[model samples]
Target: MNYTQNEKIKQVDEKTLVVGVDIAKETHYARTFDNRGIEYGKVIKFNSTREGFESFEKQIKEIAEIIGREKIIIGIELTGHYWYTLANYVNKKEMMLVQVNPYHVKRAKELECTK
Candidate 1:
Protein backbone atom coordinates (compact mmCIF):
# COMPACT_ATOMS: atom_id res chain seq x y z
CA MET A 1 0.00 0.00 0.00
CA ASN A 2 1.20 3.48 -0.83
CA TYR A 3 0.92 6.20 1.78
CA THR A 4 0.63 9.88 1.11
CA GLN A 5 3.32 12.25 2.36
CA ASN A 6 1.11 13.45 5.21
CA GLU A 7 0.21 9.90 6.13
CA LYS A 8 3.85 8.95 6.33
CA ILE A 9 4.63 11.92 8.50
CA LYS A 10 1.74 11.06 10.79
CA GLN A 11 3.21 7.65 11.50
CA VAL A 12 5.95 9.21 13.59
CA ASP A 13 5.27 10.86 16.88
CA GLU A 14 7.00 11.89 20.11
CA LYS A 15 7.38 8.29 21.22
CA THR A 16 8.80 7.18 17.91
CA LEU A 17 12.51 6.74 17.34
CA VAL A 18 13.15 7.30 13.69
CA VAL A 19 16.26 5.92 12.05
CA GLY A 20 17.44 6.96 8.64
CA VAL A 21 19.86 4.55 7.00
CA ASP A 22 22.10 4.85 4.00
CA ILE A 23 22.42 1.31 2.72
CA ALA A 24 25.44 0.20 0.77
CA LYS A 25 26.86 -3.05 -0.59
CA GLU A 26 28.96 -4.10 2.40
CA THR A 27 28.51 -1.49 5.06
CA HIS A 28 25.38 0.45 6.02
CA TYR A 29 25.32 3.77 7.86
CA ALA A 30 22.56 4.82 10.25
CA ARG A 31 21.63 7.68 12.53
CA THR A 32 18.92 7.99 15.14
CA PHE A 33 16.54 10.88 15.25
CA ASP A 34 13.44 11.83 17.13
CA ASN A 35 10.00 12.40 15.64
CA ARG A 36 10.81 16.07 15.16
CA GLY A 37 14.03 15.14 13.31
CA ILE A 38 16.40 15.93 16.12
CA GLU A 39 19.37 13.57 15.85
CA TYR A 40 20.25 11.72 19.00
CA GLY A 41 23.50 9.87 18.36
CA LYS A 42 26.48 9.59 16.06
CA VAL A 43 26.42 7.66 12.82
CA ILE A 44 27.06 3.93 13.02
CA LYS A 45 28.57 1.84 10.25
CA PHE A 46 27.62 -1.81 10.42
CA ASN A 47 28.63 -4.53 8.02
CA SER A 48 26.12 -6.77 6.27
CA THR A 49 26.49 -9.76 8.54
CA ARG A 50 24.71 -11.50 11.37
CA GLU A 51 27.09 -10.12 13.95
CA GLY A 52 26.82 -6.67 12.45
CA PHE A 53 23.04 -6.81 12.51
CA GLU A 54 23.15 -7.85 16.14
CA SER A 55 25.43 -4.94 16.92
CA PHE A 56 23.05 -2.61 15.15
CA GLU A 57 20.15 -3.95 17.17
CA LYS A 58 22.14 -3.51 20.34
CA GLN A 59 22.83 0.09 19.48
CA ILE A 60 19.18 0.72 18.71
CA LYS A 61 18.10 -0.86 21.97
CA GLU A 62 20.56 1.27 23.85
CA ILE A 63 19.30 4.38 22.19
CA ALA A 64 15.71 3.48 22.81
CA GLU A 65 16.45 2.91 26.45
CA ILE A 66 18.16 6.23 26.78
CA ILE A 67 15.38 8.09 24.98
CA GLY A 68 12.53 6.13 26.58
CA ARG A 69 10.97 5.19 23.27
CA GLU A 70 9.77 1.69 22.46
CA LYS A 71 8.62 2.36 18.92
CA ILE A 72 11.31 2.38 16.25
CA ILE A 73 10.81 3.11 12.60
CA ILE A 74 13.78 2.38 10.38
CA GLY A 75 13.83 4.08 7.00
CA ILE A 76 16.11 3.00 4.19
CA GLU A 77 16.30 3.66 0.51
CA LEU A 78 16.18 0.60 -1.72
CA THR A 79 19.71 0.59 -3.03
CA GLY A 80 19.59 -2.04 -5.75
CA HIS A 81 18.96 -5.47 -4.18
CA TYR A 82 21.06 -5.03 -1.07
CA TRP A 83 18.16 -4.31 1.30
CA TYR A 84 16.37 -7.68 1.20
CA THR A 85 18.65 -9.54 3.61
CA LEU A 86 18.74 -6.70 6.09
CA ALA A 87 15.03 -6.13 5.75
CA ASN A 88 14.36 -9.78 6.47
CA TYR A 89 16.61 -9.64 9.51
CA VAL A 90 14.90 -6.54 10.77
CA ASN A 91 11.49 -8.11 10.23
CA LYS A 92 12.50 -11.10 12.31
CA LYS A 93 13.32 -8.69 15.12
CA GLU A 94 9.78 -7.22 14.83
CA MET A 95 10.93 -3.67 14.35
CA MET A 96 9.04 -1.41 11.97
CA LEU A 97 10.83 -0.98 8.65
CA VAL A 98 10.00 1.58 5.99
CA GLN A 99 11.30 1.86 2.45
CA VAL A 100 12.07 5.42 1.48
CA ASN A 101 11.80 6.58 -2.09
CA PRO A 102 15.15 7.74 -3.48
CA TYR A 103 13.52 10.63 -5.25
CA HIS A 104 12.02 11.87 -1.99
CA VAL A 105 15.37 11.49 -0.31
CA LYS A 106 17.04 13.55 -3.05
CA ARG A 107 14.39 16.19 -2.80
CA ALA A 108 14.69 16.28 0.98
CA LYS A 109 18.45 16.71 0.69
CA GLU A 110 18.02 19.56 -1.74
CA LEU A 111 15.45 21.18 0.54
CA GLU A 112 17.82 20.86 3.48
CA CYS A 113 20.57 22.65 1.59
CA THR A 114 18.31 25.59 0.96
CA LYS A 115 17.71 26.09 4.65
Candidate 2:
Protein backbone atom coordinates (compact mmCIF):
# COMPACT_ATOMS: atom_id res chain seq x y z
CA MET A 1 0.00 0.00 0.00
CA ASN A 2 1.12 3.49 -0.82
CA TYR A 3 1.71 5.57 2.27
CA THR A 4 1.99 9.33 2.77
CA GLN A 5 2.81 11.13 5.95
CA ASN A 6 -0.19 12.71 7.60
CA GLU A 7 -0.64 14.38 10.95
CA LYS A 8 -3.86 13.59 12.73
CA ILE A 9 -5.06 13.01 16.24
CA LYS A 10 -5.85 9.37 16.93
CA GLN A 11 -8.56 8.83 19.50
CA VAL A 12 -8.41 5.39 21.05
CA ASP A 13 -10.08 3.84 24.05
CA GLU A 14 -8.36 1.99 26.85
CA LYS A 15 -9.51 -1.33 25.43
CA THR A 16 -8.36 -0.64 21.89
CA LEU A 17 -5.47 -2.78 20.70
CA VAL A 18 -3.09 -1.41 18.10
CA VAL A 19 -0.93 -4.31 17.04
CA GLY A 20 2.22 -4.30 14.93
CA VAL A 21 3.10 -7.73 13.65
CA ASP A 22 6.22 -8.86 11.86
CA ILE A 23 5.45 -11.99 9.91
CA ALA A 24 8.32 -14.31 9.14
CA LYS A 25 8.72 -17.35 6.94
CA GLU A 26 7.75 -19.70 9.77
CA THR A 27 7.04 -17.47 12.72
CA HIS A 28 5.69 -14.06 13.67
CA TYR A 29 6.41 -11.27 16.11
CA ALA A 30 3.81 -8.95 17.56
CA ARG A 31 3.56 -6.08 19.96
CA THR A 32 0.36 -4.61 21.33
CA PHE A 33 -0.40 -1.07 22.36
CA ASP A 34 -3.29 0.27 24.37
CA ASN A 35 -5.49 3.27 23.61
CA ARG A 36 -2.87 5.63 24.94
CA GLY A 37 -0.23 3.94 22.74
CA ILE A 38 1.33 2.45 25.80
CA GLU A 39 2.92 -0.99 25.62
CA TYR A 40 0.57 -3.12 27.68
CA GLY A 41 2.19 -6.45 26.91
CA LYS A 42 5.47 -8.01 25.93
CA VAL A 43 6.40 -8.94 22.39
CA ILE A 44 4.61 -12.16 21.54
CA LYS A 45 6.23 -14.70 19.25
CA PHE A 46 4.40 -17.56 17.59
CA ASN A 47 4.69 -19.96 14.71
CA SER A 48 2.92 -19.65 11.39
CA THR A 49 0.65 -22.63 11.51
CA ARG A 50 -2.73 -23.83 12.71
CA GLU A 51 -1.40 -24.36 16.20
CA GLY A 52 0.12 -20.88 16.14
CA PHE A 53 -3.13 -19.33 15.01
CA GLU A 54 -5.01 -21.14 17.73
CA SER A 55 -2.64 -19.91 20.39
CA PHE A 56 -2.78 -16.36 19.12
CA GLU A 57 -6.56 -16.44 19.02
CA LYS A 58 -6.70 -17.73 22.55
CA GLN A 59 -4.47 -15.03 23.96
CA ILE A 60 -6.04 -12.22 22.00
CA LYS A 61 -9.52 -13.33 22.95
CA GLU A 62 -8.59 -13.45 26.60
CA ILE A 63 -7.17 -9.96 26.42
CA ALA A 64 -10.21 -8.63 24.59
CA GLU A 65 -12.55 -10.20 27.09
CA ILE A 66 -10.67 -8.78 30.03
CA ILE A 67 -10.72 -5.31 28.48
CA GLY A 68 -14.22 -5.55 27.01
CA ARG A 69 -13.12 -5.06 23.43
CA GLU A 70 -15.08 -6.18 20.41
CA LYS A 71 -12.64 -5.30 17.69
CA ILE A 72 -9.03 -6.11 16.97
CA ILE A 73 -6.96 -4.02 14.58
CA ILE A 74 -3.93 -5.91 13.37
CA GLY A 75 -1.14 -4.81 11.06
CA ILE A 76 1.58 -6.81 9.38
CA GLU A 77 4.46 -6.04 7.03
CA LEU A 78 3.83 -8.39 4.17
CA THR A 79 2.01 -8.22 0.87
CA GLY A 80 0.25 -10.23 -1.82
CA HIS A 81 0.37 -14.00 -1.44
CA TYR A 82 2.71 -13.80 1.50
CA TRP A 83 -0.02 -12.45 3.72
CA TYR A 84 -3.01 -14.35 2.37
CA THR A 85 -2.90 -17.04 5.02
CA LEU A 86 -2.60 -14.60 7.87
CA ALA A 87 -5.19 -12.26 6.41
CA ASN A 88 -7.53 -15.18 5.94
CA TYR A 89 -7.06 -16.23 9.54
CA VAL A 90 -7.70 -12.68 10.68
CA ASN A 91 -10.84 -12.52 8.58
CA LYS A 92 -12.01 -15.86 9.88
CA LYS A 93 -11.59 -14.56 13.40
CA GLU A 94 -13.51 -11.37 12.49
CA MET A 95 -10.50 -9.22 13.10
CA MET A 96 -9.37 -6.31 10.98
CA LEU A 97 -6.14 -6.98 9.12
CA VAL A 98 -4.20 -4.17 7.50
CA GLN A 99 -1.08 -4.27 5.34
CA VAL A 100 1.75 -2.28 6.77
CA ASN A 101 4.77 -1.09 4.79
CA PRO A 102 8.19 -2.14 5.98
CA TYR A 103 9.31 1.45 5.63
CA HIS A 104 6.89 2.35 8.37
CA VAL A 105 8.48 -0.33 10.51
CA LYS A 106 11.94 1.09 9.90
CA ARG A 107 10.70 4.54 10.79
CA ALA A 108 8.96 3.29 13.90
CA LYS A 109 12.10 1.51 15.00
CA GLU A 110 14.08 4.69 14.48
CA LEU A 111 11.56 6.68 16.44
CA GLU A 112 11.57 4.11 19.21
CA CYS A 113 15.32 4.08 19.57
CA THR A 114 15.51 7.88 19.68
CA LYS A 115 12.78 8.08 22.26
Candidate 3:
Protein backbone atom coordinates (compact mmCIF):
# COMPACT_ATOMS: atom_id res chain seq x y z
CA MET A 1 0.00 0.00 0.00
CA ASN A 2 1.10 3.49 -0.80
CA TYR A 3 0.99 6.23 1.81
CA THR A 4 1.33 9.95 1.53
CA GLN A 5 4.01 11.67 3.62
CA ASN A 6 1.45 12.65 6.22
CA GLU A 7 0.04 9.13 6.41
CA LYS A 8 3.50 7.68 6.79
CA ILE A 9 4.28 10.18 9.54
CA LYS A 10 1.07 9.23 11.28
CA GLN A 11 2.15 5.59 11.43
CA VAL A 12 5.05 6.53 13.68
CA ASP A 13 3.87 7.29 17.15
CA GLU A 14 5.20 7.19 20.70
CA LYS A 15 5.14 3.43 20.71
CA THR A 16 7.26 3.15 17.60
CA LEU A 17 10.99 2.69 17.23
CA VAL A 18 12.39 3.75 13.88
CA VAL A 19 15.48 2.10 12.50
CA GLY A 20 17.32 3.48 9.51
CA VAL A 21 19.69 1.12 7.72
CA ASP A 22 22.53 1.92 5.36
CA ILE A 23 22.86 -0.98 2.98
CA ALA A 24 26.10 -2.19 1.44
CA LYS A 25 27.41 -5.20 -0.47
CA GLU A 26 29.00 -6.89 2.51
CA THR A 27 28.25 -4.96 5.68
CA HIS A 28 25.21 -2.94 6.68
CA TYR A 29 24.87 -0.31 9.35
CA ALA A 30 21.75 0.62 11.32
CA ARG A 31 20.80 3.40 13.63
CA THR A 32 17.86 3.59 16.00
CA PHE A 33 15.61 6.51 16.73
CA ASP A 34 12.23 7.38 18.14
CA ASN A 35 9.22 9.21 16.70
CA ARG A 36 10.57 12.60 17.73
CA GLY A 37 13.86 11.88 15.94
CA ILE A 38 15.74 11.28 19.14
CA GLU A 39 18.41 8.68 18.47
CA TYR A 40 19.02 5.71 20.69
CA GLY A 41 21.99 3.38 21.06
CA LYS A 42 25.11 3.14 18.95
CA VAL A 43 25.33 2.33 15.26
CA ILE A 44 24.73 -1.37 14.64
CA LYS A 45 26.92 -3.07 12.06
CA PHE A 46 26.17 -6.49 10.64
CA ASN A 47 27.19 -8.57 7.69
CA SER A 48 24.89 -9.45 4.81
CA THR A 49 24.25 -13.02 5.88
CA ARG A 50 21.69 -15.05 7.81
CA GLU A 51 23.71 -14.91 11.00
CA GLY A 52 24.15 -11.20 10.57
CA PHE A 53 20.45 -10.67 9.93
CA GLU A 54 19.59 -12.69 13.02
CA SER A 55 21.99 -10.58 15.05
CA PHE A 56 20.45 -7.43 13.67
CA GLU A 57 16.96 -8.64 14.62
CA LYS A 58 18.15 -9.48 18.12
CA GLN A 59 19.65 -6.04 18.55
CA ILE A 60 16.50 -4.33 17.31
CA LYS A 61 14.34 -6.31 19.71
CA GLU A 62 16.64 -5.51 22.60
CA ILE A 63 16.63 -1.82 21.80
CA ALA A 64 12.84 -1.73 21.44
CA GLU A 65 12.41 -3.44 24.77
CA ILE A 66 14.80 -1.07 26.45
CA ILE A 67 13.09 1.97 24.95
CA GLY A 68 9.61 0.65 25.69
CA ARG A 69 8.52 0.62 22.09
CA GLU A 70 6.11 -2.03 20.78
CA LYS A 71 6.21 -1.17 17.11
CA ILE A 72 9.21 -1.17 14.80
CA ILE A 73 9.60 0.47 11.40
CA ILE A 74 12.81 -0.25 9.56
CA GLY A 75 13.78 1.95 6.63
CA ILE A 76 16.54 0.89 4.25
CA GLU A 77 17.93 2.55 1.18
CA LEU A 78 17.05 0.71 -2.05
CA THR A 79 20.68 0.23 -2.92
CA GLY A 80 20.78 -1.92 -6.02
CA HIS A 81 20.02 -5.54 -5.09
CA TYR A 82 21.87 -5.51 -1.80
CA TRP A 83 18.66 -5.05 0.16
CA TYR A 84 16.70 -8.02 -1.16
CA THR A 85 17.80 -10.61 1.36
CA LEU A 86 17.43 -8.28 4.28
CA ALA A 87 14.00 -7.20 3.07
CA ASN A 88 12.88 -10.80 2.85
CA TYR A 89 14.21 -11.47 6.33
CA VAL A 90 12.32 -8.50 7.73
CA ASN A 91 9.15 -9.62 5.96
CA LYS A 92 9.35 -13.12 7.36
CA LYS A 93 9.62 -11.62 10.84
CA GLU A 94 6.37 -9.68 10.17
CA MET A 95 8.02 -6.30 10.67
CA MET A 96 7.44 -3.22 8.59
CA LEU A 97 10.11 -2.48 5.99
CA VAL A 98 10.27 0.81 4.10
CA GLN A 99 12.40 1.37 1.01
CA VAL A 100 13.95 4.80 0.68
CA ASN A 101 15.08 6.46 -2.51
CA PRO A 102 18.83 7.01 -2.80
CA TYR A 103 18.43 10.20 -4.79
CA HIS A 104 16.15 11.68 -2.19
CA VAL A 105 18.53 10.64 0.51
CA LYS A 106 21.43 12.36 -1.22
CA ARG A 107 19.43 15.53 -1.65
CA ALA A 108 18.28 15.44 1.92
CA LYS A 109 21.84 15.11 3.13
CA GLU A 110 22.91 18.01 0.97
CA LEU A 111 20.13 20.14 2.40
CA GLU A 112 21.06 19.16 5.91
CA CYS A 113 24.64 20.23 5.31
CA THR A 114 23.39 23.65 4.27
CA LYS A 115 21.50 24.12 7.48
Candidate 4:
Protein backbone atom coordinates (compact mmCIF):
# COMPACT_ATOMS: atom_id res chain seq x y z
CA MET A 1 0.00 0.00 0.00
CA ASN A 2 1.26 3.44 -0.88
CA TYR A 3 0.59 6.45 1.28
CA THR A 4 1.10 10.11 0.58
CA GLN A 5 2.81 12.29 3.17
CA ASN A 6 -0.49 13.82 4.20
CA GLU A 7 -2.15 10.42 4.40
CA LYS A 8 0.62 9.08 6.57
CA ILE A 9 0.41 12.10 8.84
CA LYS A 10 -3.32 11.67 9.20
CA GLN A 11 -3.00 8.13 10.53
CA VAL A 12 -1.79 9.28 13.89
CA ASP A 13 -4.55 10.54 16.15
CA GLU A 14 -5.13 11.40 19.81
CA LYS A 15 -5.63 7.71 20.66
CA THR A 16 -2.37 6.69 19.01
CA LEU A 17 1.09 6.33 20.50
CA VAL A 18 4.02 6.63 18.14
CA VAL A 19 7.30 5.02 19.06
CA GLY A 20 10.42 5.71 17.05
CA VAL A 21 13.32 3.26 17.44
CA ASP A 22 16.91 3.74 16.40
CA ILE A 23 18.18 0.30 15.41
CA ALA A 24 21.78 -0.70 15.90
CA LYS A 25 23.84 -3.86 15.60
CA GLU A 26 23.81 -4.74 19.30
CA THR A 27 21.60 -2.19 20.99
CA HIS A 28 18.68 0.05 20.16
CA TYR A 29 17.19 3.24 21.48
CA ALA A 30 13.54 4.22 21.52
CA ARG A 31 11.39 7.22 22.27
CA THR A 32 7.64 7.72 22.40
CA PHE A 33 5.49 10.57 21.19
CA ASP A 34 1.83 11.45 20.98
CA ASN A 35 -0.17 12.39 17.90
CA ARG A 36 0.85 16.04 18.22
CA GLY A 37 4.60 15.25 18.52
CA ILE A 38 4.76 15.71 22.25
CA GLU A 39 7.26 13.24 23.73
CA TYR A 40 5.98 10.92 26.42
CA GLY A 41 8.95 9.52 28.32
CA LYS A 42 12.68 9.02 28.58
CA VAL A 43 14.85 7.32 25.99
CA ILE A 44 14.91 3.52 26.37
CA LYS A 45 18.16 1.64 25.72
CA PHE A 46 17.70 -2.07 25.07
CA ASN A 47 19.77 -4.83 23.59
CA SER A 48 19.11 -6.66 20.32
CA THR A 49 18.28 -9.96 21.99
CA ARG A 50 14.91 -11.53 22.67
CA GLU A 51 15.05 -10.28 26.24
CA GLY A 52 15.66 -6.81 24.97
CA PHE A 53 12.71 -6.97 22.63
CA GLU A 54 10.49 -8.12 25.47
CA SER A 55 11.66 -5.23 27.60
CA PHE A 56 11.01 -2.82 24.78
CA GLU A 57 7.52 -4.22 24.36
CA LYS A 58 6.82 -3.77 28.02
CA GLN A 59 7.99 -0.20 27.94
CA ILE A 60 5.81 0.62 24.93
CA LYS A 61 2.74 -0.97 26.50
CA GLU A 62 3.32 0.82 29.79
CA ILE A 63 3.60 4.15 28.05
CA ALA A 64 0.45 3.58 26.05
CA GLU A 65 -1.51 2.59 29.13
CA ILE A 66 -0.25 5.56 31.06
CA ILE A 67 -1.21 7.93 28.29
CA GLY A 68 -4.58 6.23 27.69
CA ARG A 69 -3.77 5.44 24.09
CA GLU A 70 -5.15 2.26 22.56
CA LYS A 71 -3.06 2.10 19.41
CA ILE A 72 0.69 1.62 18.95
CA ILE A 73 2.68 2.31 15.82
CA ILE A 74 6.35 1.48 16.18
CA GLY A 75 8.68 3.08 13.65
CA ILE A 76 12.10 1.49 13.29
CA GLU A 77 15.02 2.87 11.34
CA LEU A 78 16.22 0.55 8.55
CA THR A 79 19.74 0.05 9.74
CA GLY A 80 21.85 -2.64 8.11
CA HIS A 81 20.51 -6.25 8.39
CA TYR A 82 20.03 -6.24 12.12
CA TRP A 83 16.33 -5.45 12.00
CA TYR A 84 14.96 -8.80 10.83
CA THR A 85 14.83 -10.52 14.18
CA LEU A 86 13.44 -7.51 15.94
CA ALA A 87 10.82 -7.07 13.24
CA ASN A 88 9.75 -10.68 13.57
CA TYR A 89 9.56 -10.34 17.31
CA VAL A 90 7.43 -7.23 17.14
CA ASN A 91 5.15 -8.80 14.55
CA LYS A 92 4.74 -11.93 16.61
CA LYS A 93 3.75 -9.74 19.51
CA GLU A 94 0.93 -8.32 17.36
CA MET A 95 2.05 -4.70 17.14
CA MET A 96 2.45 -2.66 13.98
CA LEU A 97 6.05 -2.10 12.91
CA VAL A 98 6.91 0.46 10.25
CA GLN A 99 10.34 0.69 8.67
CA VAL A 100 11.68 4.22 8.47
CA ASN A 101 14.17 5.57 5.97
CA PRO A 102 17.74 6.07 7.13
CA TYR A 103 18.08 9.24 5.13
CA HIS A 104 15.24 10.76 7.10
CA VAL A 105 17.01 9.87 10.33
CA LYS A 106 20.27 11.31 9.04
CA ARG A 107 18.65 14.59 8.12
CA ALA A 108 16.86 14.74 11.47
CA LYS A 109 20.11 14.15 13.30
CA GLU A 110 21.80 16.89 11.31
CA LEU A 111 19.02 19.31 12.20
CA GLU A 112 19.22 18.32 15.85
CA CYS A 113 22.97 18.87 15.95
CA THR A 114 22.70 22.33 14.44
CA LYS A 115 20.13 23.52 16.96
Off by over 4 Å in 4: none
In model 4, what is the error at residue 94, expressed in angstroms? 1.7
Clashing pairs in 1: none
Predicted structure with the largest lDDT when compared to the true one = 3
TM-score-based ranking: 3, 1, 4, 2
1 versus 2: better lDDT goes to: 1
Estimate the TM-score of every prediction: 0.92, 0.78, 0.93, 0.90
* Model 1 TM-score, all chains together: 0.92
Candidate 4 lowest-lDDT run of ten: 77-86
Cα lDDT tens digits for candidate 3, 33-107: 999999999999999999999999999999999999999999999968999999999999999999788898899
Poorest lDDT segment (10 consecutive residues) of candidate 1:
1-10
Model 1: per-residue Cα lDDT over 2-115, one tens digit each: 889899888899889999989999999999999888998899889999998999999988998899987999999997998888899999999999989999999999999995
Candidate 2 lDDT score at position 40:
52
**1-115 in candidate 4: lDDT tens per residue?**
7999898887889999999988889999999999998999999999999899999999999999999999999998876898898899999988988988889889988998995
Clashes of each: 0, 0, 0, 0
lDDT score of residue 110 within candidate 4: 96
Q: Which regions in candidate 2 have their CA more than 4 angstroms from the true location?
A: 1-15, 79-81
Candidate 2 residue lDDT tens string, 16-107 = 67777777778887877766677655777788888888888777667667667666678888744556677788889888777678888889
Question: Which residues of candidate 1, in runs, are more than 4 Å off?
Answer: 1-7
